[model samples]
Target: MLGELEMVKAVLSGSRRTVVLTGAGISVESGVPTFRGRDGSWKNYRPEDLARPDAFEARPELVWEFYNWRRESLRESEPNAAHLALAEMERKKNNFLLITQNVDGLHCRAGSRKIMEMHGSLWQIKCTKCTHAREDFSPLPPMPECPVCGHLLRPGVVWFGEPLIPGVLRVAIDEINKSDVFLAVETSSLAQPAASFYQLAKDHGAVTVEINREPTPISGFMDFALHGKASDILPELMAGLSE
Candidate 1:
């Protein structure tokens, strides 16, 4: 049997269209907190509590505090090797798409142009009472307000029990259905929609690959399961592509 690297490389070499799905694991190496593991708690509250609509509704200031802390933590973090490798892959591939669940903008900072942020970005702010949303990286006040309308502004993230921005999910599925190769990189494969994306790609005749530090629920189903840090594995895979 071919080794994992060889198998993935072979599949990628022959594919015309490729899609990559990523999650929080991809950004861990860059010092961003996973917010699901050991670092998941803040002020005795679990991430689930602060990440829900009810929590924000009950205490908008508290929710903003959590998010503000997260933003400050990620402010100085830089994209790691895995992020750079994927960006390089995008530059080389004629047809490539990146679908990510991470709210952080590391992938964009790494130079990836064709991207779908399934989870809204932390940098984006939306007015609660109007259709006003814009990307801003500047420091925000304790409680931000919309400039367009004097309404409260909230982070443009898809909180728990919230639906994704319209058309994002549809477009992602459409791309996955037509891809020739699909890679799940640094994702836990536990979240809905994204958890099933690899299966969808496989059903549609795409070669499926998983790159993660640990075996996820869908690892056994992939055509090739590469286990390691994406920062390490992706650069090696990129090297194979160049050869």
Candidate 2:
């Protein structure tokens, strides 16, 4: 196992330009459960079933209810140490790009400036019927109908059957392709395109590194795997980089 101290040293002394891909594991430190875990409160429901356009079409209210709960929960949580560490790294490292599968805005909350929210964000709501969208600071439930179109507003997240936002994905891919180092932070390799992003980074000749508690399907595929909580590991690494 690479010690956190060494990881930071490696990052600071590494080749130019670092690209990061973060996922649910990173947010788990912030008290957000993996929504699909067997013991999870939201376990019975498929995110696909609740997050899809079809679901919104059939039962917009239910979709709103589900997301409302998520929004409320998110409102109560704060960014954790790993989030702050990444944000701090962004400040020190001029060449950094952050791509996250997490819909929570914790990365931004932690002060990371250059971020590509791959799955979209909970802070934004958009109408399915129209191009209408807005950023709301209120913790109001997701039910507020679009004043313009009177259509129900939904969270601006990518559902199971939806393609990633082209602009965001293109930018993330461009950074990944140009990166000298790729960090896959606290992610399960089981997820779809999120999992495939590591492969894309590898194909571009970036050294791929993973930080996770357990071995994932991509464990062997990485140039290195560091087993530990990202909160503990990343801060330690960031401290080393500042030395």
Best by TM-score: 1
Tell me the lDDT of model 1 at 7.
72
Candidate 2 lDDT by residue in tens digits, 1-243: 556448545755565888888988898878887765664556467666788888888888888888888888888789999999999888877898888899889999999998999888988888868999887768765478887888777888888788988787678778888998888888887777677888898898888888898888998988888888999888877865742
Off by over 4 Å in 2: 2-8
Evaluated against the true structure, the overall lDDT of model 2 is 0.83
Query: Model-by-model lDDT, in order?
Result: 0.91, 0.83
Model 2 clash pairs? none
Candidate 1 lDDT trough over 10 residues, lowest sum: 1-10
lDDT, residue 185, model 1:
97
Cα lDDT for residue 11, model 1? 75
- Per-model RMSD to reference: 1.5, 1.9
- Per-residue lDDT of 16 in model 2: 87
**Stretches of model 1 off by over 4 angstroms after superposition:** 240-243
